[model samples]
Target: MKKGIIYAVLAYLTWGFLPLYWRLFTAMPAWEILAQRITWSFVFVAVLVTVSRQWRRLKSVGSNRRSAAAIVLCSIFISLNWFLFIWAVNNNHVIETSLGYYMNPLISVLFAVVFLRERLSPGQWLSLFLAGLGVLIMAVQYGHIPWVAISLAVSFALYGLAKKIAKLDVLLGLAGETIVALPVALGYLFYIQSQGTGTFTSLPPFSIILLLLSGAATAMPLFWFAKSMQLLPLSFVGFFQYIAPTTSLLLAIFLFNEPFSEGNLISFSLIWLALIIYSFVTFKKSKVKVVPISRADAL
Candidate 1:
């Protein structure tokens, strides 16, 4: 249990601070960064799998049709989530990104109901109600829609659903998703360099180093998270889920100095209140649980 708590803390800390890492490559387009990320993530995880002799499992990722289709969808959505997050962080929307992560668990509950034929308890429905009101407030604040938060939440939630269906080992699943997208990523990076629009080759040495290390940044927390999930009860881990977004919320207001308006304050209050209620009800209900995914929340 202690070890699990430690792992969970480390994983959430890493994810919480990931915005700083992604922000380092401000010169590169989000698309290029994502491509590089996918490419190097594949390289990094591929090495780990080979060294751990998990290559056999990696090969089995999409053997059957359903799993194959699911893996493809996983690749697409995770890629979208990654790009959106990186873009949002760099573009000064980190607070909105935080809001999205804050909103994700609730969003996943809705996803479960609609797509998985799952039912929600009254407490769950009440949590959703407050959350929806919060989002409605945010939408009004934005004067249209809070697309960044919604997009990130929905994309990550969809990724979680697909992941639940995939049901592969976490590392294997990541490897498969990266591999599925590897060709396009590689081609795009190659083309960008060829067209003289590439940022990688011309980046400063330190920046180049960080770019290479982004793969490690991207995948290692996931391993830590998987370890924690294995060691801890789901309910315990679920409480720890907000650490990443809460960190992001802080970083946005203090470190990055993003504006946090009154509307943001009110909406976030409602969302946080809802989460508290949902979590309280959830924890009180049972020890055996099926929980929604958190930030960096893989199945």
Candidate 2:
């Protein structure tokens, strides 16, 4: 448990620092960032799988038609989420982006109830209500729904839901997603190259290395997260997920010097309150037992 918690914290901390790392690439378009993330992540994962002798496991995911399809779908959604998130960070929308992630855990709970028909305790339900209200308040403040936040939260939640059912090992599953998107990423890079606008060729050597290196940055946290999840309870891992956004919020305010408007303050406060209620409620309830099941039922 200690090791798992440590790993989870490290993963979140790495993810939290990601905005600062990607900020260096602000001069490049988000599309280029997305493409590089895909391409480099592919390389990094391929190496890991090879060294760990997980290559045979890759065949298992590929052979499972339903799982393979689900992974491909997850890849698409994750790609979109990564692109939007990187764009938000690079374009000075980090705080808003952080807000979206602040809402993500709540969204995941909603997705569970709606799609998986999972039951939410009354406290959980109330937490969801508070979170929704927070988002609505933010939307009203902005004079429109913050669709970027909605998109990031919903897409990522769905991706998690699909991964739950797919039952592929994390490394293989992520590899599948990258492989599915590889063609598109490569084509985009090539198209940009043909047009003499390629990030790889046009950028300075250091910048190019950074862009490529971002792939390692991209894969490492995920690799750590996958291992941590395997070692920890889903409940604990869920809470740890919030650290990334919280970090982003601090980075936005302190490091990037983004203005936190009155609306942002109120919205952020509500979000923090909602999460506090939800976390406390969840932690308390996890200690209670509503039912007992046989050994086979555990599966």
Candidate 3:
């Protein structure tokens, strides 16, 4: 549990500071950044898998055609999510992007209750209602629904849904997503290069290094996240996931100096209230249950 807690914290911290890293590419096109992230992430994830002897696991999943196809479809969704997020950060929509992540847990809870037929407590229902109200307020603030935020949330939820169904090992599943995205990223990079407007060609050496590091940067936290998931319960991991967005919110507000209007404060407050209720409900439910201790606990 100690190891898991440490890994989880490290993973969220890395994710929270991602804006600092990606901001270096602000002068570049979002698509360009997305392309490099995919290409480099593929290389990094491949190496991690190979070093960890997880490659065999990939082969096993590959042999399962249904799982492979599902993963491929989900990979596309995640790539879209990634592209949107990078675009949001570069386009001064970090707060909106943070809002998307803030909505994620509530979205997941809804999915669990509706699709998985999981039971929900009254607190959970109230939490969802408050979250809906918050979203409504945001829509009013923007004079339209924030599609970028919604897309990020929906695409990621679908991606998580795919991951649950794929049932492949973590590293192998990630390798699949990167592999699916690799060709498109390479094609885009080459096309941009041919146009003589490629960021890669014009970037300084340090920028290039950072861009390359983006791959490992992206992969490393994910590796830690997977490790934590192995050691922790789904509920604990689900809660830990919120740390990333909370950190992102801080970065967006203070570090990035994004505008924080009264409406934003109100909307964010509602979201937090909703999250509190959701956590309380979940915790209450948890207390009513009993779990057997495992061999690891015996140690």
Candidate 4:
């Protein structure tokens, strides 16, 4: 349990601090950065798969057309999520990015009800209502929809749904998706290079190193998160999930100096309230017991 807590904390801390890492590449276009991330992430995971001897499982995924299709869909969602997040960070929309993650769990609940045909408890219904109210309040205040938050939430929710249906092991599933994305990523990088506008051509050695390290940044926390989930209850892991967005929120307010108007506070407060209610109900029903962990737990 202690090890699980430590691992979970480190995983979320890494995710929280990721904005700092991506900010180092502010000079690069989000698309290029995303291409490099997908390409190098595959390279990194390929090595891990070899070392762990998980290639057989990865091969099995390719043999199953349904699984491959699910992974392809997952890749698209994750790539979209990654690009938007990198873009949001570079564009100084960190608060909006954080709001997206804050909305993610609630969005997942809604997805479950709608697509999975799962029945929601009373607490779940109220929680969803509160979250919707929060979004509405933010829209009213900003005079525009909080599209960044909504897009992030919905894309990630869809990614989670794909993973749930695919039912592959976490590492294997990631490898599959990254492999599926690798060709397009390479093609984009090649096209950009041909245009003579790619950052790779002009970047300093240090920046190049950082770009390569994007692979580690993308995969390592996920590895730690998977390890932690293996040791902890799903409910405990769910509780820890809030740490990432909370850290992002703090970073946005203090480190990044993003705008935090009164309306933002009121909106976030409602969402937090909803999360608190949701967590309480989940814990009460699960009785803090460990269950067979699912891919949704990792998300």
Backbone clashes under 3 angstroms, per model: 0, 0, 0, 0
TM-score of 3: 0.88
Compute the lDDT for candidate 4: 0.80
Query: Candidate 2's residue-wise lDDT over 1-299, tens digit each?
Result: 56777887888789888998998888789998899899999998888889889888888778888988897898888899999998888878887788787777776676666776766667766766776677667667767678788898878777767766566687888788888998999999899989988656767898888888887898778767766666654434655667888899899999899887787778777777767887777667765745678899998
Provide the overall lDDT of each model, using Cα atoms, as 2-decimal numbers.
0.80, 0.78, 0.78, 0.80
lDDT of 1 by residue, 1-299 (tens): 66887887898788889998888888899999999999889999999888889987666656778777888998899899999999999899888888787667666666667776765668867877897788678667777667888898888778767766566677887788889999999999899888999888889999988888888988888667666656654434544656788889889899999888899789878878877887777656654555777878673
Among the numbered candidates, top lDDT falls to 4
Which stretches in model 3 have alpha-carbon errors above 4 Å? 1-13, 224-241, 291-299
**Which model is ahead, 1 or 2, in terms of TM-score?**
2
Scored against the true structure, residue 280 in model 4 reaches a CA lDDT of 78
Write down the lDDT that model 2 would get. 0.78
- Identify the superior model by lDDT, candidate 1 or candidate 4: 4
Give the runs in model 4 whose Cα sits over 4 Å from its true position.
1-12, 223-241, 288-299
lDDT of 1 at 251: 92
Per-model TM-score on C-alpha atoms: 0.85, 0.87, 0.88, 0.85
Q: What is the Å distance of residue 219 in model 4 from its true position?
A: 1.6
Show pairs that collide, candidate 2. Answer: none
Give the residue spans of candidate 2 off by over 4 A: 1-8, 227-239, 289-299
Range of the 10 consecutive residues with the lowest summed lDDT in candidate 1? 232-241
